[model samples]
Target: MTKGIQNSETPLFLLSMMMENPEAAELCFPQLLNNSCRKPLPPQSDGMLVYIVLSFISLLTVTLNLLVIISISNFRQLHNPTNLLILSLAVSDFLVGLLLMPAEILHTEACWFFGDHMCALNYVVDFIITSSSVGNMVLISIDRYLAICDPLQYTNKVTLDRTKICVCLCWICSVLYNSLILNNFLRHPDEQNSCYGECVVILNNITGTVDFVFTFISPITVIIFLYARVFVVAVSQARTMRSHIATVALQRSVKVTAKKSEMKAARTLGVVVVVFLICICPYYSPTLVGQDIEDSSSSSPFVVWLLYFNSCLNPVIYAFFYPWFRKSIKLIVTLQILQPDSCNAGIM
Candidate 1:
C-alpha cells in the first residue's frame, strides 16, 4: 500500500515539474537535454489559425506570380524593355513565394530542423532575392523617368538589349553583394547561437548601418526623387498641351498620342513603386530605430509577411491595370498556351 502511494506521487511530481518548466516541457531535441532550444508552443487554436492563413497566402503568392511569368513570357506583343524589367521583378517575387514564404512559415511556428548550414544558405538566398527585387525597382523607376521626362532620348537610350544586360548585371551584383555581406555568418552559422534548434544571424552595428543606407535609404531616395521629377514634368506637360491645343493641331496630335502612351505607362509603374514602398517600409522599421537587423526571430512576423506579401500583390496590380494580363490569364487557364504559334497571339 505504501509503495503504491509513493509510485503515484512520483508520477504526479514529474508531471508537475514538466508543466512548470517551459523549456523542459517542450524541446526541439529532447535527447540533447541542456543543448537544445525550447520549441515554441503557442496555444493550439492560435497556431492553427496562423498556419491556415499564412499557408493560404503562400499559395496565392505562388499562383499569382506564376501567372505573371506566363503572361509576360508567352506573349510576343508584351516583349519590350519595360516588360522585361517587369519579368525580372516577377521572377524575384515568384522565388519569394516559392522558397522564402514557406520557410518563413516554418521558422515562425516551429523549430529549425534543417541544421545550421541550411540556415546560412537560407539567409543568403533571402538577401539575394531582396536585393534583386530592390534593384529591379530602381531600374523600373529609371526606365519610367527617361520615358516620361525625356521622350526623344528614351528610344535611343533604353533598348531591349541594353535592358536585358542591365537585368543580368542587377542579379549578378545582388549575388555578389549579399555573398560579401553574409560571408561571416555563412562561414560560422553556429557562432552566435545559444542552443541547437534556433537559427539566427546577426550583423554588427557598422555593417548593419551600411546595409541600411544602401539597401533602404539610398534606393528609396532615388525612387522618390525620380518620381517627384516625373510628377512635376507630367503636370507641366498637361498644362502646356491644353494651352497649345488649338495652335498645333496635326503635329500636336501625333506628339500627344506618344505622350499619352508614356504618361499611362508612368502612372502604372508609379502604382507599383508605391505598393513596393508600403510593404517594405515595415520590414526595415527595426533598422530605422537603430536596432540590429535580425530577420529570423527578432523581427516581427507581421512585418516580414507584409514584405513577402508584396510579391503576391504586384501581379494583382498588373491584372487590374493591364488588360493584356487579364487576357493572357484566360489563355493560360484554358490551356491554349500549348498551341503552336500561341506566342504570336494578340495579347496587347
Candidate 2:
C-alpha cells in the first residue's frame, strides 16, 4: 500500500517541477519550436549572484584597460618603442573587455540571438584579437632582449616608426591568419550548431593541432627563449654595476642610471609575460589532452573567462608596478589632460 502511494505522488512531483520551471519545457524559439534550441539548464547556484559577479568583471576589465590606453596615448613621454608595444597590448585587451567579455556573458544564455554569420565573425574576431595580443608580447620580449642584451644598437633597431609599422603588421597578419584557420567555418556558419538558436564552432583534430602549434607553441617558445637570454644579460649587468668602482664619476653616474632603467623595464615586462602564460595555459590544455575545441553549451565557463581575465589583470599589474602609470592615471582622472601642454608633462 505504501509503494502504491509513493508511485501515485510521483506524477504530482513532476508536475510541480515543470510548473516551477516553465522555461525548461519551452524551446528557445517558440514560433517554430520543433527544430529550435532548448533553453539553458538552470544554474547550480544563485543565478542572480552569477550575473552580478560577471557583470562586475566585465566592467572592471573595460575600465582598467582603457586607462592603459589613455595613459599611453595622451602622454608624449610614454611614446617609446616599448610603450608602443604595451599600447598595442592594451588595445587588444580593451577589445577583449569591450567585446569578448560581453559575448562570453551572452553564452550563458545558451541560445544565440544573432544569426549564423555573426557567430562566425565573433569567433574569428576572438582568435584575431588573442593572436595579436601574443604577437605584441613577443615584440615586447624582442624589444627588451635587444635593449638589455644588445643595448648599443637597441635604439637604432627599435625606433618609434618601426614599432608602429610592426604593430600594424601584427594586426593585419592576425586577421589573415585566423581567417585562414576559420575559412571553412565562415563558409558554413551553422554547420557545427546542434540546434536553430545555438551558435557553435568546431575545430577538428587537424585544425586544432595546427592552431595550437602556430598560435601557442611557436610563440611561447620564442618568448621563453628571448626572456631567458634577457634575464642572464640583465643579471650580469647588475653584478657589473655592483662590483666595478669607476674612476670617472660623471661617466659612471650616467652609465649606472641607464643600466638601472633598462633592467627595471626588463623586470616589469617579465612579470607581464609570466602572468600572461598563467592565464593562457589552461585554455589550450584541452588541446594537450586530445579534446576537440568547440564552443558549445557543454563548455566550461571557467576556461573562457580565465583567458579574458588576463586582460584585466595586465592593467592592474601596470598600475601596481609602474609609478608613471599611476601618475598618468591621476592626470587622466582629474581631467588635467584637458589643460594646455599636459601631453608634454614628464611621466618617467
Candidate 3:
C-alpha cells in the first residue's frame, strides 16, 4: 500500500514541476525536445491585447501610406518635386507596414516558422527600407533648406527630373550598402542560432559600430545641421518680411507670398524630421551603451516597435499640416477618383 501511494505521488510531483517551469509547457519541436526552442506562451489575455493593438497599428499604417501614394500619384497638381520625395517615402513606409511590421510581430511573439533564407531576406529588406527612409529625410531637409535660403535658384535646382534621379540613387545605394553590411548574415542566416528551432543573426562589435556610425550618426548629423541652417534663415526671412510690411506694400506683397510659402514648407518638413528623429533615436540607444545593435528578432520589442511606429505617424503629420492631403483623402474615400480626368483635379 505504501509503495502504491509513492508511485501516485511521483506522477503528481512531475506534473507540478512541468506546471511550474514555463519552458516545459510546450516545445516548438517535440521530436527533438531538448534541442528545440520552447514555444513562447504569454498569458492569453495579455497576448490577445498585444495582438489587437499591434494588428491595428499595422493595418492603419498600410491604409494611411496607401492613401498618400494614391493621392500624389493620381493628381497632376501634386506631382511637384517635394511631393515626389513624399511618394518615395510612402512607398518605403507602405512596405514596412505590409512586410516588416508583421514579421516583427512574429519575431517578438512567436518562433521562426519561415526558413533561414527567409530570415536573411527579411533583415535585408528591413535594412534597405530603414536606410531609404533616412536618406529621404535628409533629401527633404536639403530641399527645404534650398527653398528657404536660396529661393531665387530653388526652382531650377530642385526640378522633378533631378528629384527623381536623386530618389533612384538613394534607393540603389541603400540596397548596396545594407547588403554589404549584412553580408555575413546573408551567407549564414542560422549561424547564430543556439538550437534547431531558432533563427538569429548576430553582429560583432566592429560591424555594430560601423552600422551605428554610418546609418545613425552620419545621417542624423547631416539632417540636424541642415535643419539648423534652415531655422536661422527662416527666422531671418520672417523678420525681413515683417519689416518690409511697413515700408513697401506692392513690392513686399509678392516677396511675402513667396517667403510665406517657403516658411510653411519648412515648418511642415521640420515636423517630419523631428518625428523621425524621435522614433529612430530609441532604436540606437542600446548600441550607444556598447550593446550590439541587434535587429527586431533579438532587440528590445519596445524600441523596434517605436521605430516602426514612425512610418504610421508620418502620414498623420502630412494630413494634419497639408490641406491638399485632407482634400485628396476625402476625394479618395468618396470614390471621386473614378471620375474622368481625376488626375487633373485641383487638390492644391
lDDT of 2 at 217: 95
Index of the highest-lDDT prediction = 1
CA lDDT scores, all candidates in order: 0.86, 0.85, 0.85
Question: What lDDT would candidate 2 get against the real structure?
Answer: 0.85
Q: Report how far off residue 332 is in candidate 1 (Å).
A: 0.4
Which regions in candidate 3 have their CA more than 4 angstroms from the true location?
1-25, 245-255
Per-residue CA lDDT of model 3 for 209-269, tens digit only, reads 9988989999999999999998887777678766754646654554576576767878988
Greater lDDT among 1 and 3 belongs to 1
The candidate with the higher TM-score, 2 or 3, is 3
lDDT of 2 by residue, 40-72 (tens): 766666886887788898899899889999899
Best-to-worst TM-score order: 1, 3, 2
TM-score list, all predictions = 0.90, 0.89, 0.90
RMSD of 2: 8.2
Q: What is the lDDT of residue 172 in candidate 2?
A: 97
Please state every model's RMSD to the true fold in angstroms.
7.0, 8.2, 7.7
- The 10-residue segment of model 3 with minimum total lDDT is 1-10
